[model samples]
Target: MTTVRPLSCPHCGGKEFSFPDKGRCRCLACRSEFLLDETPKPSPARPSGGAGPRRLAALCFLLLLLAGLLYALAPAPAPQPASQPARQRAATPAVTYELQQLALAADPTRDGAPLVLRVRGGLGQKGPAGYVADCYDPRTQAWSEETQRLQDAVGKNAREIRFQAMSDGSLFLVLDKSRLFSFDFAARQWVDARPLLERQPRLAGGVVQIEIGYANEGDALRVMTADGTRRYFYPAVDLAPTYDELRRMVADYRHPQAERRHGFTFARKGAGTSGPQQLIRYAFLDNKTGPRLFGGYLEWDGEGQARHVKRHAHIFRQAHLEATDFFTPDRVYYRASVAWADKEDLIISFRPTPHPDAPSLLQSLDPEDGAIRWTLQCNFDGELVKTADGFYLLQGAKLFRISEGRRPLAEPQRLF
Candidate 1:
């Protein structure tokens, strides 16, 4: 590209001019000349001034050649800024469900506030696939049998169940030889959903176990098995079943046949044992690695591919081994010598049997080694209310703060 600028003669006021090579400009008026020597000049003569004309001519020619070469090599006009490539986005944080409230009322056992249990069971009688869920409220405390009937409780067909409640309110329910069904508490209806392992996943040695965890987002669920395979579930969207591949899963909920096993003992004040809201058998892993988890059913069905799911394993990772024999709903005083160890390992002992009975004996693990570091044995009179500090154990018509630990917590004067 070239640019032109007008040249005028100062003396004669002539407007006409012609541009020449090498920075030179000529004006017709007064015959004025400007920058007529942009071209390279010959190097100064040697100090001795003895160089021949032929030698000087050769030097001048080389200088001119070098100047032409330099001009030719000048950079081309700055190129248009190269189109910037699109930036990649960071991944979303994992989903998690945290506690919103533990509503308490005069008769929590009567629905104003109810205890929450995350469980796993079958969808219908002998529904082939077992599933898991937060089995809403108890039928006894429910509004009425008719209303309760409207609710979708885990049917009898479910043969196996496994559950874990994370620090965040996220609840994981795993089942086997069955599938899951989701309930819309507000709608009093069952949401149409599919089973995650509808085809059931099989594992080596023909053993399988299922486990679930909720990430920090609370939007998705992570599923894991004894075999190290993982899957994720997004509750917000519908899942495409055609994209799923049914893998082999644990064939039965029989603990004797399980590749891994965990046990529990649920008992109340004087009661030997009680039935659980839901029941299912499962294998347990002893460590954070190596052992595989296979077999489990979910509470609801949607996105069916387990491979595509993300398993945040650390959420339910416990540090103690729980006594697994007692699986009941009646017993309040329950002791579980679980798989992991530590105070935060979730090693707890419940007391007083189910509802109305209140908790009596309590135990927790040591945060350091998951050892049974604390225990509470109480003889009280009425109902009970619990908090991190202690529990208000009620027996008969009397209410008392039944506490046992390093420093006994002071009993509050009154509780409405």
Candidate 2:
């Protein structure tokens, strides 16, 4: 509705006004009517105080209201929980093989290690006494002679018992009679491996050397005479081999006179490879330098024909075992034969302790250059069988299952 502006009527000059129609206005006092001017009056020139600032303030107020409404209506960002500090990762146990002289001053492996076994079996039980076998039960911290009862009667007469490891986590008890008995840890049973080891070549320390592992049908057994003058290889078999049957299986005729006259032992055949390749080890005792080892790898086909041959030696040069190692203050007092060897590595015994009762060091070396790879203070006296995970160290009558771990070298807890 438009407001009628009062005007002096033309007849009576009245100031009163009224809206008689949509656009006409009437003056009541003078009874006069006229068209109403509905146009808005132009705003007065900005007041002395300036209305421009007032308009701007109103616009700002509206923007603020709109922002507040949006903030309230929109979903709130996750609480974020006051930005909790990042959780630190759990620390891994620190473990290292002590290679430094300072770190090895005190033997940590034996100081308080729980006794797992005590050798009670001996060769005198019948003939020349063999080592007594026992096992350590970590759960009970007690020693038990579980291995002694599992052997065949012949195995009981061996001068000493040896651990022959297989890739499938099976263990072979190699008796002195060139016989083998299998024991499965998972099955907790003994296998009559006597058939597989029938007519085996004699093996002894400081005398004959024998090594056996996986072959196609069963195992590829090897025997080397003390002088390494004669080496015999027996392929996998399906049945117990007769004395004459085994003689024909020996591959001694395939080697050269030089290799036969001296000795060759495999370093690594990558025993993992079930192919036609295998490792041959070479042993030489030069009167001037003492003893040295070499690796000879042979690749052949099903026809028993040679495909490739590689030879490696001088792997222990860094050890200097032939030089001042066993004499000087470097603490290398004694050097022993390899306790473990493969194509790529050689694990040997180094007696560093002057005290006869102290433990010896087990050092792994690179087969290519005899460079020391790692050294662990172990009391096994170069007696052990390796598995994929680590190895079982045989100390006295007890067997300790040692795993490769990162825990710092510290006194073992009284968990035994």
Candidate 2 on 210-270: residue-level lDDT in tens?
A: 4453332123344545565433333232222333443343322121212212222322223
lDDT tens per residue, model 1, 1-416: 55344445554656776677557667776666666443234454455655677798999999999999999999887769766555534554443321111111122223322333333333454432233233323223333223122224443543444333332222333444233334443443334333533433332232233334332222233444455554443332321111022121112112222234443322222223342212112235332211123312211112322112121233223222222221332222333222222223333444434565565544544433334555655433333434343344433323344443233344422322
After TM-score superposition, the amount by which residue 67's alpha carbon in candidate 1 deviates from its true location, in angstroms, is: 99
Model 2: CA > 4 A from native: 1-170, 174-180, 194-235, 238-334, 343-346, 351-360, 366-382, 388-391, 400-403, 406-416
Candidate 2's displacement at residue 302, Å, is: 43
Best by TM-score: 2
How many clashes in each structure?
93, 27
